[model samples]
Target chain A: MIRIENLSKSFTLHNQSGVVIPVMAGAHLAVQPGECVALTGQSGSGKSTLMRMIYGNYLAAGGSIMVGDVDVAKASPREIIRLRRETLGYVSQFLRVVPRVPTRTVVAEPLLALGIPSDQAHARAEHLLEQLNIPQRLWSLSPTTFSGGEQQRVNIARGFAHDYPALLLDEPTASLDAKNREVVLSLIEAAKARGAAIVGIFHDEAARDRVCDRTVDVTGFTPQRAA
Target chain B: MTQDQPLLSVRDLAKMYGGRIGCTDVSFDLWPGEVLGIVGESGSGKSTLLGCLSGQLAADRGQILYRGRDTRQMSEPERRLLSRTEWAFVHQNPRDGLRMGVSAGGNVGERLMAVGARHYGDIRETATDWLGRVEISAERIDDRPRQFSGGMQQRLQIARNLVTSPKLVFMDEPTGGLDVSVQARLLDLLRGLVRDMGLSVIIVTHDLAVARLLADRLMVMKDGHVIEHGLTDQVLDDPQAAYTQLLVSSVLQV
Candidate 1:
């Protein structure tokens, strides 16, 4: 389970006169095991910032984020990376799979980052990809050659390959066609069935309705004043 | 429809690079207010054909006539002027069509500022009006494209292209990256805009539903050839070519 309270983050923007303007503010969210939550908001609504905070990708400035016994808000850099590698799986809106790396290798990279043996990690990756319906012939090729829909599938496969109990997905279905959308969401459902806690940001209401166990509308959150 | 003085016309438009044909012998006409849809798969050369027609890519052999004048013979300045003033292109990724770091108003009003709109107040008003027409809120005019949702960014891209009132517009998978509900709303907005403005458009897509909703006529392409061309309903409901039939049949379930 994950809990967030009074979380706040801000970024400085330079004006024409070189004045810095701060944006972002206090936000709150929580996710529990086997529960899928949808984060919905307009661009710049701080949804991504909040997700990154949950992963300790950004240090929360104002409040506490508790993931089991770890306080993500106060965690050191090394501790955060270890927590991310061992306990969380994160996917971005933009699929940024490294080019020239084999799809299977990329899927297993997270395991490798955790110092898992190559042979064992790869075997696990192969099984996951097969279950996700990725063709065997394409497993050794870099994702660059794959189509948009295909690349997304590979990305999803990589995120869930390690079986990290908590998953965070940002706009995973944004670029897929209808058929691929169904496949990707089905994969998520399977992950849920296997007991992964998932939080995904979605611009598509229909996708949220279909896959999300709960929905949080962030449109009503008031923009906090800059300090 | 073909006309003696069509706004744009292409004949035998084929593009081949290193012996790989992009699109071969493709011909089409854009009257002042017509909407033509091009549908095909990834390797079917739909985007390549649009690139060739727009002069973004060179054709192996063809005639591109604008107002009865051959664009193939036009000077670089002339082509540039035509693109900036009379022709507009909409890319699938709005970021591709826009300068991301600039203000949304700047992105929409850049074409006008390029040719000669020096008055800042006038440009702002025009940009706001176009945004309003496209259903973007007034306050978002100052936000950068990066600060918009995928759907809002696409709408801003449309506003940017249409602000110039170009005689012809080319859209490549405008709704390709959006959500299903967003796609439906955008399709409705585009259909209404086209009818109300009497704009001429050429939309490239792989979705039959998109073709059905946004186009008056449809053309199916595959492996560098226009395999089928006819009224939208006819081509989709009852196709002539085996390729078009396969493409249409792929969309239906069971």
Candidate 2:
């Protein structure tokens, strides 16, 4: 369901006299439906860069990132948004929710964006929160003020609330306790069973081994050592 | 109309004032039930872009297609009718959009009347319902907007515009000039209403926070040019252009 070809990326340092730095070159990958692929690389390697390119956060130097029928690299802003809303989902390491929005609403937002009824969406959010061990009392509060671990768990809940056809997960099980990590790993397994194609960055080797069908090392994609 | 077709399509739209550019080469599509945000510093042509889209200002170049037909080709009365029915414009200053001399009920009732609702009782009843929706009390129906607080006036203006259930709405700083708490409340109400009503909105704001909260897609303008455009979270989180990066940094410069 997700495929990328001839992908390359470079960063232009405009403040430093417009110096363009080539990062990744000639990268390619594909993930079929019901498969989970892990992106693995050393620090500063193009692991996150490739992931960002797939998510369309970084404009590609040249390539096609096909998530379903839409080429994320070439899709217009609106098309990318539509693809994100209905086809693909991403869970970044950091939680970036609007301040003061209740955690329930934040978690339920994706389903709501799809025109799902509020009661149904909220129930699904609550179920995910409960599965991840978040306290019921905190459901009405904003996730911003939660602890780092709590915030990460909330982020995971939001990402998993919708059954997106394709998903990009960044360190989803990072910094979690053993029990919560198992919960997340099983969530990944369940997603795969339900036919989702997932690409993720996993630092936890055990979690990576347990959930990912294969690991694509990003070191080969880098053209030069990142400075 | 097909469900996937964009409700509004803007192509190479440009506007100029004698020797100066208002907005130039602006283009984007707004899908049904989508929210697009234009953000920039003052005089960056965000407001000019908004005015041209809402039919308040004529563009010097390009087409604004509302559901496949170019709106610029429409006659005056036809465009007026469209504005009164399918389109609504919310000004930065509520006073500019409101009928200050009229009662709150009359202000909202006027929009329904414009759409051919002639029965006085039904108009007043719908007007009262909309006032309640915007959190204005029914008893205040007869009070002129001149007496309402800034926040209340803005809410009443919203009721007036939305009472017609316009499919597409253009908002220029809908929360400008309100207190922080009041702005939050207004945004809350707006968010709920937009979702419930499936509104297609084009909002211009200098407040990145507001844009983040309400916008699905974002276009960053600088010196009358669109420097960057992307999903709201993507643009705000990892802005690529130099101008957008500077703007994002300043927002986080607490």
Candidate 3:
């Protein structure tokens, strides 16, 4: 299970003459295991920021984010690494991998980080990459050279490589074609079947309908100052 | 040679340092735009195999054919020209790949100059463009590599090696010395560039994560011998070799 309570985060822009920008304030949400929650909001409504906060990429100014028993907001860097390794998974809009690395390795990385053996990790990554329909020929090339759709598939594969307890997905299917989108939807179903808690941002209503069990409107939790 | 022939081929290649073996009976074929990874623990001879294949170290026996020509038969100047114009090597350390005293733009521009690129303005413009492509700001073009962070230096080194648009690249642990976040970002940038340019690459690393992510095919080496070779997925998912299985399981236990 994952829970966020009175979560507030703001960024001070030093480049903009030290002006403070409130991203999220007093936002509260809970995602139970086996449930998928979609974050809905307009552009700049802090949907991505909220996701990053949950992933411990952004520090919250106040409040709490609890994933399983660890409070993400208060967790140390080491604790966060362990949580990411064993429990939390994230699929960002863009795929990040070492230069000159092949797709199979990129997909298998998260598992390897969790101390999964190379062969097993490779097997899982290969399955996910195949599921996403990334061509075997392109698997040896760098994702940097991949098309937007292909890169997203690699990103999705990395995220789903492990059976994480909690997952955060940012537009997992944004660049995907219909066939690939269907694959992602099925993967999400499988994750939920295993009782993983999920929070995602889905601009496509059809995709949202397919996987999201509920919706949370970010605008409702917008910081008062920003509002 | 047929049009479908491999871009590079190695057969029964062997190397030795005095009485000690470096690598023996290695063989493989690399298609254009394909990425092949060689993996093993330290002293496993993966590095020696890479050195022999890249022509940095001479092989004691067997053959290496590049674009249908035997590399051993090529003149010294011819080999130098090939290294400068058609091939690139990315070292594990950024310092090895980059010239710290020179400006970033100069580092990239020099590669172009080596390949007979003239027109000073054109060189500078291309350097700046490559910097941007590698996710480095153009504003840092004049800064020396010493002034850059480790991640930035690695990115700059990539931009330098890639500015000439070499058809083949060899990388040795390109991400071995960086924070996790920085490594991820660098990998992303590298992937995009290789894909965009349709480069053929050979990479050496002990880190299976890197092999899994980048190599199309993989060769597993142990004690100067090739233990396993197959599609990256096959070698990793269902390794047939006992050594490879142990390597896979040991990484997991770590």
Candidate 4:
């Protein structure tokens, strides 16, 4: 289970002479295991910010994010690393692969981090990449040269590679083609069936309708900046 | 053991010091999170084999593939980056692994710095955290490794190597030169950290007990060749090769 309460995050832009911008304020949500919650919002409504906070990528100004027994907001770096390894999995809008590393390795890394045998990790990565329709020829090449749709597939493969307790997906199917989007939708269904609690931003309404059991509007939680 | 692409693949890897064979025709695949223990008498090419695998010593023949790329073909800078970030080598002597001149915190912080962690506070916090993880006292963070006891120095060395959260670590006699009690404690600490981090490790040890404690799989070497290899329990229990049988029975008699 995942819980978020009174989540507020503000970024003080130094370039704008220390102008403090509030992204999210007083947001509250709870998601049960096996539930898929879609975060719906217009551009700049703090959906991504909320998700990042849940994943502990961004420090919340004030709030609590509970994933299972661990409070992500207050967890130590070691605790966060453990959560990432065994409990929580995240897929952001962009795929960050090490330069010159092969696509197969990028996908296999998470499983390797969990101490899964390399053979098993690579095999699982291959299976996921195959399901995502990544070409066999591209497996050994770096995804840095790949198209946006192709890279999104790689990101999805890496994200779904682990069977985590909680998963955060930020625009998972955004740049993907219809075929790839359907594949992602099915993957989400499988994850849900496996009892994974998922929080996602699905711009594709059909994708949201297919995977999300409930919707949380970020617009309601976001505060408009003062002039 | 499993039919999956290896994280590290070595084919007919050989290194020689003049006419003497350091290691010959050493071919194997290391799987992720799997600890491959290379055990043999001193000069049986255990250190030589590790040197070749770690890119510290160049191979005289054959290919070493890391993540499916030939490591021998990789540029020096690329190999250095891999060593500094993805791979770690823990030397038999703590002095070889740690900088005696630097503070314990700085030793651990150096690896983070190499990887581009510019925030001093974050680096110091991480260094302190790792020091604690490796059973070093928080108070000794400012003390140099030269000022520490042998066991503490070794623990600090391990902390330094692991601070980067490397996927693979190569340990050469990590428990060597320590008192029996200290060795036992260090082994326990190492076992816990290894399990928690899910790190893939290749450990070279002459101590059979060390192999039994740390290794998932055993690779027995003799005269610069791998005489036998199997799961730790199976090899230690059944003893397939004659040399391995001798090795196992010798430990039992002690």
Candidate 5:
């Protein structure tokens, strides 16, 4: 469902004396629908930068990223935003719940962002939460009270609730214990079974082994390394 | 069961806020050059115990003794300096353990700088040495944490803590965000470092397997207290506490 060719990213760096040094270089990746791929590499291997390119968080310096016929690399800002909203989903390594937002509201925020009516959005979110077995008692409560595992579940619920055709998750199972990790993995599998194209950046080896059909080694893919 | 003064000691430690509980009647003495793994479910108060031991939070009751010195009796600045120079904590989120926007070198050297190391070249050299030891390339020294991978960021966190060579180290799920292979590598690195340095460590984790791998002794906590504590093999091989049994069985492969 997605195609990327010759994708490259770089940033200019400044030295101790304020001299600029350019870092990052041409990187490439391609992900298919109904498939899970694991990106493995050491730090500064450009794994995250590659994900950012696909997620449209960073503008690629060169090459093309096409998702279902839309050229994400060349798409206008509005077009990219729409594509991100309607066609793609992302779960960050850090759970990015807007502090102070209720769990129910955080779950429903995307639906509202998609311009669904408030009532309809709330109903959809509530229904999904019920299906996911989120307790009704905590529906209006902020996610801060929930533990890391609970917060991860909420993150998964939000990412998949929208039913986007393609999903991109960056290390979704990092915070979970073994049991909860299994649950989240099963959920991801269920999403794939429902025909959602999924690409995940993973750190947990067990999670990666369970969810991914293929692995892409990031070593030698880039020159970035922690000093 | 009291022996010669332990490096750190906790007795009947209880912390409660309002109706909420942190830990209850928690007691443990950490000996020199031993690794203690604290295992628990989320909200099991493992983190709170770490906070109490590190003096990040004052115990509502009970005494924390560091080499016979009552931590509660120490003045704020005294405790602060002790916590800074003699003890180190590695939090779950590397971001919490580090200044995210700072360069890797800066993150690794900050502790030294705080302890009054003023030579930029000396700090940079030390940072480089630690990074290399942690398997991080020196080229990325100037890059911000944002530019590193999750595993790299975690290693940077470790480098930062270990560079100070603190007598006692507290790690809360150091590999919580790493992949299996990376976790293995990091665990190996940590094990080796602890052995070579004879560093005392308390690692809090929910992963019983992880506990088995690194800890000489294991303590399983549920709710707010340690339900079981023993040698790692004894605890995992024959858990006396039902909670520990459940936890051990849950993570073991059939």
Candidate 6:
């Protein structure tokens, strides 16, 4: 389960006369096990900010963001890294490729981190890549030079390779073809069925309706409106 | 030791040389099977940090806890025993770590002997196996390191250090003196060995590409200060510090 209470954030511009920009305020949300909540908002409404705060990517100004019992906002970097390795998974839109690392290794890295045998991990990664429609020939090659769609597929494969208890997916279906989109939707459905608590940003209305259990409009948490 | 505790825990570690800062207030935990790369320019004190951690140089301040035991607090002989058994260091120059006058087999077998392998045949077989693993042939085992190429000597040095299966390895610019192709081959061999053996490594390198290839986490040093430390890919790709950004950007494309 994931929980957030009294969450707020602000950005300070150190340069240009030291301006402070309050982004979100008094945000509260809770997600149960096996539930998928989609964040809905226009640009700049703090949807990504909220997700990043939950994942401990953005340090929250105030509030507790809990994935299970540990508060991500208060956790040390070591705790956060451990939490990411074991309990939580994030699938961003982009694949940050380390040049010369094979695509199979990249996709299998999550499972490998969990101490699964490399051969078994690679097998699961290959399965996910196949399901995501990446070519077999590309498995041995690195994903750095791949096309946008190919890289996205590789990212998805890496994300779903491990059965993480909680997940934050940023545009999981973005830049996918129709067939791949269908595959991604089914992956989300499968994750939900397997009791994963998910927070996702889906711009596609149909996909949101199909996979997300409910929608939380981040517009309600904007700092100016809250003030 | 607790199951979740870090393999190596360093707190407020610092070393200085006559009012000149070597590395100051460097703190981090190296988890089991993790590779932590210390990267900076020529005088950044990355090598200084390595020397202090590997027990080759004594630190002026702070504590280094290896598996719940403070290394600095240990007696000299105990620390030496730990160094010979559970710890290994690979130098940038192979001559620094390898006994150039000794045969390649003898260089590796000496580590086994240090760890109490009295049987000659067994030590020789293990030395030969390790030599082959590092891609040096059996025939070269009897030859002195002076007869080997730079890369072969480096490989022989790796065989010497790893023959004991040290729990933690300290490598300072392990590929610094090698050509590009040789460096690539050595990196590949190291990667495979690291994964297969689950070795915990503290590697200090000026090469970002080397850090990118080998390290799980990275600490970017500047003027003896740790300016940035994070996951290697995160630090490299989305570098927050201006110094780290410059360091990453300055890598040549060719």
C-alpha root-mean-square deviation, each candidate: 24.9, 2.5, 19.2, 23.8, 24.5, 3.9
Q: In model 5 chain A, which range of ten residues has the least summed lDDT?
A: A12-21
Superposition TM-score, candidate 6 onto the true structure? 0.83
Which regions of candidate 2 are displaced past 4 Å? Answer: A225-227, B136-147, B237-240
Give a tens-digit lDDT track for model 1, residues B136-220: 9999889999999999999999889888888788899999979976886687677656755667898999988888767767889
DockQ of 2: 0.39
Q: Give the range where candidate 4 chain A is weakest over 10 consecutive residues by summed lDDT.
A: A11-20
Which consecutive 10 residues in model 6 chain A have the weakest lDDT in total?
A11-20
The better candidate by lDDT, 2 or 5, is 2
Residue pairs with backbone atoms closer than 3 Å in model 5 (clashes):
A13-A21, A203-B179, A204-B179, A205-B180, A227-B138, A227-B140, A227-B141
Q: Pick out the ten consecutive residues of candidate 1 chain B with the lowest summed lDDT.
A: B233-242
**Which model, 3 or 6, shows the larger lDDT?**
6
Docking class of 3: incorrect
Docking class of 4: incorrect
lDDT, residue A218, candidate 5? 64
Candidate 5 segments whose C-alpha is farther than 4 A from its true place: A1-227, B1-4, B252-254
Residue lDDT tens for model 3, A31-83: 99999999998998989888887877666789999999999888754456568
Kindly report which residue stretches of model 6 are placed more than 4 angstroms away from their true locations once superposed. Answer: A11-22, A225-227, B26-29, B99-107, B118-121, B124-157, B175-195, B206-222, B226-254
Worst 10 contiguous positions by lDDT, candidate 3 chain B: B231-240
Candidate 2 vs. true structure, TM-score: 0.91
> Which is the winner by DockQ between candidate 2 and candidate 3?
2
Return the TM-score for candidate 3, rounded to 2 decimals: 0.57
Best by lDDT: 2
Score candidate 6 by lDDT.
Answer: 0.89
Whole-model lDDT per candidate:
0.79, 0.91, 0.86, 0.85, 0.78, 0.89
Interface RMSD of 6: 4.7
